[model samples]
Target: MPALQTINVSKSYGNFKALDKVSIEVGKQSIFGLLGPNGAGKTTLLRIINMISVMDEGKVLLNGKPVKQSDIRNIGYLPEERGLYKKMKVGEQAIYLARLKGLGKQEAIKGLKEWFEKFDITSWWNKKVEELSKGMQQKIQFIATVLHQPDLLIFDEPFSGFDPINVNLLKDEILKLREKGATIIFSTHNMASVEELCDHIALIDNSKTILSGEINEVKQRFKDNVFEVSYRSLSPLSLPAGHFEQVETQQQNGVFVSKIRLLNGNKPNDLLQQL
Candidate 1:
């Protein structure tokens, strides 16, 4: 059974529709990229999954059963906006949030300590959240989100406010979480991150799901079959007229490299045979 599933979910405010029959299935231990442009209902769908808001129609399922209010305890969410309490001390706020997610005081402290040490932020434990930099606070909130070992994790634009090094750090940790049996719904506009991290993707546009499937399959579906081939020969090879349309050609190190697209709808194998 999929770890999470939404069937025909929809939401609206006043006369403006926010979501329209958006559906997605997230397999266990897999990374599912929720991709969309601004105001495309990504946040609304996430709110429905997080139970922060009720859907106007359809149901959200966990492990093949309809999600119950009680099931929310097993889910973790880190929204795009900052959620940390600014006046609270870093360690204190993290422990408080982790406890709210069902961790005990002792367990929360232990888990949070380990994460802080790993991130080399142990020195900031006693510092107030208002005193930390934006990137520092983001790390603290991330630790709180994952400390309780939730079954499903939702990260909305989690890469905000981080340097490239920290971005790589967070990316590695996300992959590790999936390897350890957590299903993740990652919402972001970063196409490079999507290509690097996601096994599958669902693209929403105009408040509706316009694409959903395995990542490579989706890319292939959207691809125009263009090919570039390099050959070492005595002279430059010419493509047969009416068979292939040449886009560009160049010579490098006595090798002829040709870029071509299908003009006559010739199969890729036919082009290779022609070469």
Candidate 2:
């Protein structure tokens, strides 16, 4: 059974309909991406799943059973907006959040120490949250989110404040979580990260799921049959107009690279023969 499933989830706030019949299935221990442009209701769908907001029409299931309030214990959510108390010490706040997620005092402390040490932020323990940079605070938020070790995790724009090095660090950790049998719902606008981390994805636009599937299948479905060719040509290149349409051409390092799209049922072999 899928670790989580949302069926025809719809939600509205006043006159604005935030979601419309959005449905998705996340396999067990898989990294599922919730993708969409801003105002596309991706966050709304996530909120519904996390039970921070209720859906007007739809069902949320965990392991094929209807979700309940108690099931909140099974999820860890890191919102796009950071919410640490600015005046609270980093370690204290993290412990509080972890305890809220059902971790015991000692467990939270041990987990926080391990995570802080791993992230190289052990010295920031007693510092107020406001003393840290955005990226530093982001790391703290991430540790608190996962310290409870919930089976399912929802991270909204988890890489927002990190530098490239930290980005890869967190990416590696996320992959490690999946390897350890946790299902993750990752929401982000970074297509590169989606390609690297997500096993399946759903694209929401204007309050509806416009596309969804395994990543490679979605790529194949939208492929335009364009091919890039790189050759060392002595004379000006020529192609039969009916067989191929040249989209772009550029010279790099003594090689001519051109992007060509097959036309009128012509194949690459047909283009090769013409060349």
Q: Top TM-score: which candidate number?
A: 2
User: Global lDDT for candidate 1?
Assistant: 0.89
User: Which regions of candidate 1 are displaced past 4 Å?
Assistant: 227-241, 246-259, 264-275
lDDT for each candidate structure: 0.89, 0.90
Tens-digit per-residue lDDT, 103-129, candidate 1: 899999999989988898999999999
What is residue 168's positional error in candidate 2, in angstroms? 0.6
User: Model 2: clashing residue pairs?
Assistant: none
lDDT of 2 by residue, 1-275 (tens): 99999999999999999999999999999999988888899999888988999999999999999989988998999998767899999999999999998889999999999998888889999999999888888888899888888899999998887899999999999999889989999988776765788889999999999999998899889989798888898754798777788899999777998899998988778878766
lDDT (Cα) of model 2: 0.90
Candidate 2's displacement at residue 140, Å, is 0.3
Question: Per-candidate TM vs. native?
Answer: 0.88, 0.92
Query: What's the C-alpha lDDT at position 210 in model 1?
Result: 96
